[model samples]
Target chain A: MEQFDNVSVSKRANVYFDGLCVSYTVTLADGTRKTVGVIQPSKLVFNTGAPEVMELVEGECRVVLPGESEAKTFKGGESFSIPGNSSFNIEVVSALHYVCHYG
Target chain B: MEQFDNVSVSKRANVYFDGLCVSYTVTLADGTRKTVGVIQPSKLVFNTGAPEVMELVEGECRVVLPGESEAKTFKGGESFSIPGNSSFNIEVVSALHYVCHYG
Candidate 1:
């Protein structure tokens, strides 16, 4: 879907990595929490508290998931999974727009 | 309120000024359109296509409205209005989180 319907969205954004990453918290009708965000062209490591599915809405990036050595390129319409209590390294070739789902 | 409830928010973001300003379009149930956005610390001029009421959720900035000489400083919990087809200049002293309400 191009948008989320009947959802609650926080006004304040979550800014990370000196503003390289910015996202808004979205709460679905079922109380599932997601984040809609953008990552500028940069390389960054993100640590996760819960397992996450990063669904790319647009742009391109190469990600090295935890316990992996080779980076995998993911673009718009693609997604990658990150294990809980772990981290992943991502190199954004272009600005990345994504929706992050927590598990 | 800290959030917008029962709204439809677009998945993609509107990135401007080379990622200095990022915003997401939100559509209310009644079809009113708004945007939740963040502006990094910088000086920029923005033209308005429609009259706008910029509600600042957090951060600091000085703005010069169209046809004005001196700039005014505004912070969180404040708001400024711009006429349609006009423009304004803003200097963000800190990262600005805002909701843009269109008329």
Candidate 2:
């Protein structure tokens, strides 16, 4: 039988992007772990192969997709997805905390 | 030209789920908005139709799928995706913050 434990978020490390700091942690079956803070725009677009990814921001939400040719807005507490292999831009208009995951 | 503004997160409303609180907001193209806090499990499964969805938890990440019969784990700052039309369960085992978005 295999037993695994849950990973905890570290207080010292939190991901900061735009102007927001998103909290997160990574845990593996063997109990290995790591902490990360702040996901940068370059990283967001880097190797964009995963099906999910998230960025946190503070204040208002402004989303501009070059292909869409239109800006879509989002409110705090509202979550949306940015499709894979698409070029898009996002900014944290205010102060907000967002957590994202990809498959 | 159609002008749209970004949405902000309300200090009063923060979404809580399982044992963790998720920060988010929903902004529209027309500026209509609402504040929400804490996403319940029933609600996570209620809509059930979207390309992406996310959940946050504190401590070690433990993912269990009945179909696969395997448990996958995640660390803080590590994001993954949950495919559309899949059944799953998550718990915020610690005092942590997590944000989830769906499209």
Candidate 3:
């Protein structure tokens, strides 16, 4: 979808790595928590407390999942899953627009 | 308010000034448009296509509105208005979080 309808969104953004990554919290009508965000072209490591499925809306990146030696490339319309309590390395090849669905 | 409820938010963001400023478009139920954004510490100039009310949620900045010789300092819980078709110069002393109401 191009947009999330009838949701609650935080006005304040979550800025990471000195603003290389910026995201807003979004709550669906059913109370599902998600984050719509953009990651500027940069390499970053992210640790997850909850299992996450990152749905890319636009742009490109290569992600190395937990225990994985090979990096998987993903782009707009693709997605990748990360296990809970795991850390992943991501190198954004282009500005990445994504919606993170959390467990 | 900390958030906007019952709104439609675009999945993609509006990235400006090479990612110095990032904002997401939000559409209220009644069709009013707004943007929740963050501006990293920097000096930047912005031109407006419509009248805008910039409501700061956090951080600080000095803004020189159109036709104003002096820059006015504004911080969290403060706001400034900019006329349509005008431009403003803002020097961000700290990262700024804001909600922009536009017409």
DockQ per candidate: 0.89, 0.02, 0.95
Best by lDDT: 3
- Looking at model 3, residue A48 earns an lDDT score of 99
Model 2 lDDT tens row, A1-103: 0111232333222433322334334343344443222322232222234444454332356677546766677654565666676556665454434445555
Tell me the spans in candidate 2 whose CA falls farther than 4 Å from its real position.
A1-7, A10-23, A26-47, A53-59, B1-103
Give each model a TM-score: 0.98, 0.32, 0.98
lDDT of 3 by residue, B50-86 (tens): 9999999999999998998999999999999999999
Q: Which ten residues in a row have the lowest lDDT in candidate 3 chain B?
A: B94-103
lDDT of 1 by residue, A37-94 (tens): 9999999999999999999999999999898899999999999999999989999999
- Report lDDT (CA) for all predictions: 0.96, 0.40, 0.97
Output the better candidate (2/3) by lDDT: 3
Model 3 segments more than 4 A misplaced: none
lDDT of 1 by residue, B1-103 (tens): 9999999999999999878899999999899999999999999989899899999999999999998999999998999999999989999999999999997
Per-model chain A TM = 0.98, 0.51, 0.98
Fraction of native A-B contacts kept, per candidate:
0.81, 0.00, 0.93
Interface RMSD for candidate 1 relative to the native interface: 0.6
lDDT of 3 by residue, A1-103 (tens): 8999999999999999999999999999999999999999999999999999999999999999999999999999999999999999999999999999998
